[model samples]
Target chain A: EAGVTQFPSHSVIEKGQTVTLRCDPISGHDNLYWYRRVMGKEIKFLLHFVKESKQDESGMPNNRFLAERTGGTYSTLKVQPAELEDSGVYFCASSPGGDSPLHFGNGTRLTVT
Target chain B: SQQGEEDPQALSIQEGENATMNCSYKTSINNLQWYRQNSGRGLVHLILIRSNEREKHSGRLRVTLDTSKKSSSLLITASRAADTASYFCATRDPGAGSYQLTFGKGTKLSVIP
Candidate 1:
């Protein structure tokens, strides 16, 4: 089966601009998650989705960040009015369910200047 | 907050040698997992070791978990140049209902040919 896939492997935007990153999980996977790694920092969890319903979003950084999973399939992470600090790699992952290990995508590298 | 910290932030070894990375966590975990990420790429799950298990192996990878010390180690035997990447250890809290994972800073390994 194909692994999780993310689009626009790299993105460059100016501060205050809006950027959207997309992720398509493996077929039949119901659990989707978002994560990010800033320069010199460990990868941090952003949020999670279980079949279009947010399972957890406590890790979201702020109100400017939003995520959506429509039709219980693919997911999108949007950063409005992006800031210089928002420049980093945004990763998306998926799993079948329960405690299964996650499969990740190549991630989208966003550079906000 | 970061749950785990990897030892020896970076390592370099020649091919056919062994590379070991250690991770120390602050709390109890349901399971510990190792992942490898090539530069500019997403992470790939290497293996998972439960709290109760002591050791597990997959191909050239060997993982050891020591609950008593709240630490874990990953060893790649007969390493090859292709194994060059950053290796990270992630943990899932036993009491956390959410499946989000807490990751360590990671160890960057350079395998020379």
Candidate 2:
């Protein structure tokens, strides 16, 4: 089976611009998660989706960031008025749920200049 | 905030040798998982050990969890150059009320051939 796939492996945008990252989870997986790793920092959770419903979005950093999992098959993360500090690698993962391991995608590396 | 802390931050081992990395988490967890990421690649799940499991092994990879100490260790036997990558420990905390895994600042392992 194909693993989780992310779009635009690398993205570069200017500060104050908007950027969106996409993730397609593995088939039959009900749980999708978003995480990011800033330079010199640990990977932190952003949000989670369970079949089109937002399960946990407490990890979202600010209002400027938005995530949606429409149809529960794929997810998109958008950052409006992006700041230089928002540059990082955004990773998407999916699982069958209930203590199962997650399958991750090759993250989208966003560079805000 | 990062819940799991990986020791050594980095590691270097010669081929045919063994590599061991440790992770300590702050909260009670249901299970702990280890992942590997090669340069410019997505994270690949390596192993998972439940709170009730003391030791689990798959091929050359071995994981041990000590829930009492809130710590876990990953051991890679007969390391090869291909094993060179960043190894991360992620914990699934039950209290977090979500399936999102809390990751640590990974240990960068360099396997010298």
Per-model TM-score, in order, reads 0.98, 0.97
Runs with alpha carbons beyond 4 Å of true place in candidate 1: none
Q: Across residues A1-113, which tens digit of lDDT does each residue of candidate 2 receive?
A: 99999998999999999999999999999999999999999999999899999999999999999999888899999999899999999999999988888899999999999
Q: Model 1: how far is B46 from its true place, Å?
A: 0.6
Cα-based lDDT at residue A34, candidate 2: 95
Model 2 TM-score, all chains together: 0.97
Residue pairs of candidate 1 with colliding backbone atoms: none
Local error of candidate 1 at residue B16 (angstroms): 0.9
Indicate which candidate wins on DockQ. Answer: 2
Residues A20-104, candidate 1: write the lDDT tens digits.
Answer: 9999999999999999999899999999999999999989999999999999999999999899999999999999987788999
lDDT of 1 by residue, B1-113 (tens): 35788987999999999999999999999999999999988899999999989999999999999999999999999999999999999999877657999998899999999
